[model samples]
Target chain A: MKKLLLSGMLAAALFFAGCDGTSDPALPPSSDFTVTFKALYDGQTLEKFKSYDYDTYKVNFSRFNTFLSDITLLKGNEEIKISDIEWVDFTPDSAFGNLTVSVPVKFKNVPDGDYTGIRIGYGVKPELNAKRPNNFQSTHPLSRENEYWLGWGSYIFNKVEGKADLDNSGAFGTSLVYHCGSDAVYRTYTFNTPIQVEQGAAATVEFDLKKLFTINGSWFDMKIPANQFTSNDVGNVIVATILMDNFDAATTVIQ
Target chain B: MKKNNAGWTFKISTFSAVLLIFLMLDACKKDDPPVEDRDDDLVAIPYNPKSYTIPKPEIFPEVPVPPDNPVTVDGIQLGRRLFYDPILSADSTQSCATCHLSSGSFTDNKDVSTGIDGIAGRRSSMSLLNVAYVSRPLFWDGRSPSLEDQALRPVEDPIEMHNTWANVLDKLKTHASYPAYFRQAFGITSRKQITKELAAKAIAQFERILISSGNSKFDRYLAGDPDALDDEELDGKLMFFDEGGLLGLPDAQCFHCHGGITNTGFSFFNNGLDSVASLNDFKDKGRGEVTGNINDNGRFATPTLRNVALSAPYMHDGRFNTLEDVVEHYSKNGKGVSNEDPLIRQLGFPIPGTNPVKYSGLTEYQKKAIVKFLHTLTDIDFVNNPDINNPF
Candidate 1:
């Protein structure tokens, strides 16, 4: 009986040793999970040249890439931070995979519990935004090729490139290129939703680009001449303001 | 007693196991030393220390130097020789100074510089005056990140020097003076260590010394010389600075991009050069090609206006033959493009009893005054400085 009891205690100690010391007797055991992000346009998954009716014109996205960083899960103010930054490229030829419409961000060793909400920064955090691409590790999202505006001394937080046909001429004549950046434009998005994360089960979140572009019962008119934004103060501020206003309403937790 | 012995043995074995695991983990965590630290592992060699201090002109900002490649007297001298020596070329008939002549403010007078093979380059040579003050991303497109990186490109460019770095290295290794020069400059033990990196560093050191001392009329005026500038020049300064309310003159809108002592912010802009329906319609992608971004199409780095009078055939492509042509282009504003910078769009003065016209915001007299003010930035002492001259 004594030997059996000693063996049991030894096994329990061995099991606890493998953990990172964050395990609590009151809480459930930690587990691995993933948060999958989806990009949608007009309530449908993104497709190039898929005509989306706006206020006065039809729009189609040829390219869309955004930097998402500082992803955190809040369990009643108990912050579970993920030290990973991801660049979600919705373009057809994205290196993540061909025809991949959704990006899955994995979280390991997460304390299994009920998360009140998830907080994610839309772009690089302000502290990390000032650093140039060359300063980051080559594989880091901040080190993306052609994403940094060297002259402007900032990284393009989001790139939404496409065309618009104002007159419905069947030809996408008007070019829409909104390269948004600047430390002043970095935004944080919080989704207030109950998320029951079980051990080894994945939670999903969806980013609806359609809702993001919609404002006041009208779609954002990319055909506006001034809307062809760059990294300059006036244009970038205009585009960034529109994006921030619509982002909170658009994002939703699917699971 | 037996139970006590068994407990002691178990405790000792468990402690040994923990110690073994920690040792293995520590061994696994060992990482390679940093590149700079690894250099110390090499055999030591006798290094002759020689420092080169760059003269700071009151008009310009403090020059930035790379930590790895410190300026040295031997490095600058070797770089000066290499700048003028045709030995770096495939045919031994051309050098960096061939295209960047000191007389033309380090720019070839031709619209496009001709190489050793007489093949013309796509873009005109840029002036080297006050280049040390330029921050990251050199060249018209802002591709190369440093002057050291910029120095290595022309040597191997097919239309330029047309020589491989290996061939150039071999030539330098065989040369009697270069091996010793490399030794003194970089503290290299042998000629084999004389690499393109050291060569480029030397060249960069020499380029850093090319500063525009505050001897120009504008510099004198800033130095509290009340009569340094004439009334017309002062009016032009006001127009350039766009202090219209204070000077009671029209703003030329030049200070939006070309402000400060360096006369440029060194940022890239489309400047409304082309009116293409699509972003892909640009002839020379400019910064767009370097960045691979469609929005950056037709954008080029803003060149400094210092010594603009001497550096003729301006613009990246050298389309404008003179400063007047440049002034005229700005006066008309550029052919508006879709990606044209907002700052470059529709700048003009309000005509009497008419809607504001699109063009330069300056009147004809204001344009002349602005041109005269630009001439005040010409530091003849900089162009004529003998220290930066070619050393054969």
Candidate 2:
């Protein structure tokens, strides 16, 4: 009878605890992380249809979009994941002059803490890249029909599209499209800087798109038009490699 | 005594006949379906809405179905009927099919469609074939975002069907078949519950089902059938897709705007259609008028080339009558305007001092081959799909 009474008391304790409308004590307090990715030309925010100086020519960017995967913050050996995948679209419907053409990816339930740095996997990782659009639902970001190239048997990892006025003439004539794709083009970069993830506020990380066009000191020449880079086209692969090598230098923590 | 007995029998027989008549009348009254709402009339029909899986090309992306309006079998049927029915028009002489015909891959085969009031619309009737996956902000100007919203426009368009929603509602409420259809499709309890939104939803469901057959020669070739395309067609396909760039063939650059499985991009582009003096001088101001952006002048939604061979006269205004003409137009250094897509300006071979874009690189033979290749995109199976045909 003592054992039965003890059991009943335990059951009552569990029932009342569940009905208290309180969260589990075991889980840590988490906060939302808002990471804004900006596409830029040189040091300023990139604007579509606006002319910018590239070498001797004036250039215009029509599109600049990339898929950032496995965005995680590093705290020593520990990692806090922000997003598995984000289709960062810098291609605005209209031109925004001075302001950054950017998209913010918000992640909720991020365990608040101070972090060493952040690591971003550029392009869909090998595992997710293996699957087709049909593998996922329509709502999945990777299910974009236009991004997936049947020729490459993979998603087009990055699109840096623009036109260059080869001559200083008024008309912008030359088209340059460097749509990098394939497993070989997939890469990741770690920005090794202190990042703090607080409970109420968001810690931002900025990726400059202009850095993708340059490495060390040299800038990618837009006059060299090799539009077909969806697959391992030799002419395009050379161009794509130049840009992919610059990925590490492109990103950094803003705050 | 005998006469009294006979009188009693006659009276009993008369009473029995009257009782039987009364019971028969009562039975007849009970058998009639109860008028739930006497004024508007209840459509007494079974409302078992079966889910519909819109036929999609295996090579294509997932068919985009809005969250609120899940497709139903009855909904599709009702939509199909409405699409072909002329009753939606003010004059009862035109329908959605008046502009979009199935045999022509949902194009009326006219340069610009003449509306019910005999007025010509500014743009061509875009092909409804494979429109389910069309990158959003639909229509040439990107004015309407959803097919449901787009379906509502023509009926009310002064030059088009030229009918008000009020008139359409009244007609649908009183429609002998539509009320029953509404009950089956949307589970409307009464005919009065028939709404423009429900009608539009039904039509949207029907439009979503109008997808590609994916049995085109290009699709077959991509699906690993090596013999699907001929030598010339293969060459054209290679050039069009810039696969020939590896083989030292010049990038035709058709895929820049018209790439992807559906042969179209997701955004609006000024495809160098007209040589405007300036952005403001554009006669139509197509996408510009919609967005209020001067840079967007002369831009139109990039259309799919699934059944392009049948969908001429081509372009937003249906300017190009034949595929050959279309190719020639692209070959020429486009009349350079401020916002003309760079792809057009870079059409020709690069020369030393002269703007390489100024010259047309495509030889006469190459143009023909490209046109021949475009023919392979014609999906006869889609055009002949009986499921999407006129319900009438």
Best by DockQ: 2
DockQ of each: 0.03, 0.39
**How does chain A of every candidate compare to the true chain A by TM-score?**
0.83, 0.83
- Give the docking tier of candidate 1: incorrect
Question: Which regions of candidate 2 deviate over 4 angstroms?
Answer: A1-22, A54-57, A92-101, A223-236, B1-43, B348-360
State model 2's lDDT. 0.79
TM-scores, all models, native as reference: 0.58, 0.88
lDDT of 1 by residue, A179-226 (tens): 676777778878877776666668776667678777766766665555
**DockQ, 0 to 1 scale, candidate 1:** 0.03
TM-score of 1: 0.58
Per-candidate Cα lDDT values, in order, are 0.72, 0.79
lDDT of 1 by residue, B129-242 (tens): 877766436788888888899999999999999999999998997786787777778887767677898899998888888777789998898777979999888888876764
User: Compared with the true structure, what per-residue lDDT tens digits does model 2 show for residues B1-392?
Assistant: 79999999999999999999999999988886655444336445788989988777677778889889999999999999999999999989999999999988998999898888899988899888778777658888888888989998999999899999999998987777888898899987787788899999999999999888889999898778999999889888877876675555555778766777777657788888897778899889988888787878888888887789999999998889999988888877767776777566544345545533244378777888788889999999988989999878
